[model samples]
Target: MQTTSTYKILVVDDDPDIVEMLHYNLTREGYHVAQAGNGKTAIEEAQAFKPDIILLDVMMPVLDGIAACRQLRDISEFRHTHIIFLTARSEEFSEVAAFEAGADDFLTKPIKPRALLSRLAAFKRRDAQQDEISNVIEIAGLRIDRTSFAVYKGDSKITLPKKEFELLSFLAATPNKVFSREELLHNIWGSDVYVIARTVDVHIRKVREKIGEENIRTIKGVGYKFNTD
Candidate 1:
């Protein structure tokens, strides 16, 4: 339901050239774009602009992107916002740190505008689909309330992390339809998040523990499926 004019994006980077580049491309693509010079400024702008998506740089003065992302995640208003960290750093630790800080995705420097636009388009599609399916989902003795962001199994309400809840809800939305790990990652985290395949397995195990393993079936070499039968 995000029209081009209504979709707001905040581009945060210390480099003016990069910021200008993103602003130009995003505007040309019919999105509302704003720019910030550093992480601190990005945080301030995010508060005022309430952008739907944020493209934040990893390194900056006043405050670093990871810390800024963490701060934003702590706030209820920005908790579900799409935040993608932009970094020149290629180290695995840096990527891990970004995710731990609550970034939805990460992007390497020297960005290709066309590719970025494609990813954004894909995200919009998924976001719209999720919106349509946000009503309470009940399947296999599980009750998922998207509005309350809560899940229940039988009579007991389960406490689940944000990602786990999303994963479970998505699987239960279409019971018995096997979804590959890669597909889950793409749909849940967006196409740009660079998480390893093991990440999905870890989350799956955690979800299974909370919801009971019998509900979610592993397809060995293939993927996973929710059993409604």
Candidate 2:
């Protein structure tokens, strides 16, 4: 069970005012907040700040939100970080694209503070409930502990970025379940993001690098499934 102090958040946006506004509002709601002006900073903040959740922007210089989200997805530690993309693009295709990029939700720009707060509260509820389910899973020498938010390979602790850890843990939790990329985005990444199924592949590759090539079974045409047996 994580305490309230553990619920820190990172807000990624190039717009200074947006960052300031969100930082203030979220702080007022009692959430610890950090700010990143670009995708590069976002990743650095993600790694260093270790925020529990992230509010990432869709457009920025150096690195866009989508690209940044993909980068975060590669890291094991931030794998499960709740990410909501705040953007001005609201086209149907764009919304779908966000989901493909591995976002938990999307909020068009000129955000309604009330709606943002409500959605965050909902995510918080789900996060707390999920925290109770337990995360201890072992496949041979590899062990993952969800409750403690840790992973290990033969007693040696291994660190992962946010998205990478979540992907491994999710697949591990359901060994043998043939999960399509779209399914992963919807279930693991959340449907609101607008990326593509390929993002799942990116995450999988990084995870395999951490664990082993044989640890994850990619069913080529179908999708990905954990090789528990």
Candidate 3:
């Protein structure tokens, strides 16, 4: 429902060229843009700017993007914010590390301006669609509230990163029905986001750690399902 001009974007990278390029491109698209030269500054700017999207570089001085992202994910105010990792490293381990640190999307630089914009547009479309879905789901003594992006297990509240929470909620909504990793990837992250299948396993493991292993079941080769019985 909101226009591009209403969206706030934070571009965090150590390179001045990268920051300037991203700022120019994003601003040209009518998005409100801010820049940070390192991870520490990025965090400070994020607190004040409250950007809806962050393009964070993996390698930076002071704090690194992975650490910065983990810290940001801990803040309740940024629970739903989209954090995309940008790195020149295309190694599998780097990709895995980014996802584990709470990154929603990973892009290897030599950044493609058009692809980046498309990813942001996809996120906007997904958000609009999510707005129409039911806000809360209660199952097996756990409460998943989409409106507040909160999850409660009985009287205690559990903190889960964005992707973990979405994976949990999606499975819980259709209790006892099995869903493959590919299916879940398409539904939760959307077809526009590029992430490996192992990313699903990482999120599932994290969710189970917080909410208990009994709630979600692995159906051997079939994928995963929420246990209702």
- Candidate with maximal lDDT: 3
Q: Which candidate is the best by TM-score?
A: 3
What TM-score would you give candidate 1 relative to the actual structure?
A: 0.77
lDDT score for residue 95 of model 2:
58
Which of the predicted structures, 2 or 3, would earn the higher TM-score when compared with the native? 3
**Candidate 2 global CA lDDT score:** 0.79
lDDT of 1 by residue, 140-226 (tens): 788999866688888898876566778888898889999999999887876655676766777788789888989999999999999
User: Any runs in candidate 3 off by more than 4 Å, and if so which?
Assistant: 89-93
Model 1: per-residue Cα lDDT at residue 31: 93
Clashing pairs in 1: none
- Runs in model 1 lying further than 4 Å from the true structure: 89-93, 139-142, 147-163, 174-180, 190-194, 201-229
Please list the C-alpha lDDT of all candidates, in the order they appear: 0.82, 0.79, 0.90
lDDT of 3: 0.90
| TM-scores for the candidates | 0.77, 0.65, 0.95
Instruction: Please give, for residues 69-183, the per-residue lDDT of candidate 3 as tens digits.
Output: 9999888888779999998855344667888888999777899999999999999998787777767998999999976668999999998877788889899989999999999
Our model 2 lands, by Cα RMSD against the true structure, at 4.9
